[model samples]
Target: MTATLQPVLSADAMVRDAAGRAFDDLAADWFRSEATFPDDAARVRKRQALLNAVAALGFADALASPDAREAWVDAASILRAQARSAAPIDMALLLATGDRLASIAGDPSLYECAADAGLPGNAQAVLALALGRCLQICAALEAALDLSLQYVQDRRQFGRPLARFQAIQHSLAIAAEELAASTALTDLALACMVREGCASARLPGLLDAAALVLGHAIDVVYDASHQAHGAIGFTREYPLHRHSLNLLRWRDDLQRLRGGELRCAERLGDAALQAQGVWSAVTALMQPGDRHD
Candidate 1:
């Protein structure tokens, strides 16, 4: 869109409406320019332009202090904007949300400070957690969208494109589950974040839990979408490559850090006690030199 993240909607408006418009405008510009990048340098320039715009909008400053609920809402707008604009920008914004949450985790003053400033700390925590989860899951949605678009354009098994097949419908149905699950969890987390509760203390734990589930669910969506798309789905020109790469990056980097398949399995069954115990042990075992691979 533009190089400044302006508040198109007034603060007097409901948060939902305000949040919706912020991203809608940027996304409009984003998708309009999708695939318009002529080269790698162009892509970098475009992403930098968007980041400067978002930062100018004061997007990342949400963590400047303990009381920043409005900033969080706006921060989310920047994220949605970058998600449609550029992959690296989107990944950076999403991962940054986690860093902000981690920053929240150690600040004990957040509760009273938030209350004094008309921001709800517990709810903010939930929103923060959901923000990170949503960003990570965006990789899955990207993968599904990429593969679905490519396959619908090119695969022909019978007398027509694979998109016309009943089996293709089944595949979409399965992949959509991942999309829906992540979206639903995000909504729940946001709701909890807005409501004041003791849940704040448990946010880090909740985030770890959601990260595990979303991480694994994304893989399912990626594999199924590619299968439905067939051989063309594997091609380099396939638009799926961009999204698939992002998914791979997220899975390998962020998801794996919290523990990937093993964490997912534990959360899938008897999550309450197992997650708590596992986090306790993992926290104890963590060292300065630890590495994922």
Candidate 2:
């Protein structure tokens, strides 16, 4: 038998393409109808299938790699794609962070003994959780924005389209800005995590950054989306409610998982103080080539 060589793709491109195709296929197979929502058995089976597909693509192993930067970037791509889908599966939490948790679960004592031992992995998990939630929230907010735009354009009041009203347009514009800002922050956090690596001493700073971005993004996006969507957004029949509820629920879960933003901020502050100054602490993690000025 002759051996065949497989072609390799860039990590980011490979993850982005595979994740998109997988999620699209999953949505087609499972999320096509409202019946999928109420059926617990179907949802679980579909979600499991989705996870298996992602694992087959090597996403789970990438997240556990010793090369933290590459792992974080790959995980982020997978998470963003999962978030873009209308499917109810929390693949980001389950596939990305869950894999890491399982890896360390065999030895609880090791984690409990050293104060600084599990900090790196915990920080990574926390950041992953935040990234996943941010992507999910962004997806929901964008969907809400689309729905609002379509509604205002089609809905008429007093012989004119609702979109013709300056108030409605202004509200939507504000919502769009919030979404853009949130997405930008999420991107920035991901970039930092990939650049510095999870085991870097600046991991706490990265956690602090993720905490701030996720916290503020969720708040702004939630309020703006709900306001733009109005009464119908809360209704179960409307697709907006699913995204909104998920965002609301995940935000709470993320906060509790990481001890909230205040604690994160305080930890960063302490680290800065210990290093004598915040700027010095930040620069300490910088490589010789990283400093431009």
TM-score of each: 0.52, 0.62
Please provide the root mean square deviation of candidate 1 (C-alpha atoms, Å).
Answer: 14.2
What overall lDDT, based on C-alpha atoms, would model 1 receive against the true structure?
0.49
Residue 279, candidate 1: alpha-carbon lDDT: 58
For model 2 the local lDDT of residue 90 reads 43
Give the poorly placed runs of model 1, Cα more than 4 Å off: 1-66, 86-130, 139-143, 146-150, 153-155, 194-199, 256-271, 274-293
Best lDDT goes to which candidate?
A: 2
Per-residue lDDT over 127-214 for candidate 2, one digit per residue giving the tens place of the 0 to 100 score = 5555555555666667667777887887787799888988878877877887787666566555555655444445445546556666
Worst 10 contiguous positions by lDDT, candidate 1:
284-293
Candidate 2 weakest lDDT stretch, 10 residues: 106-115
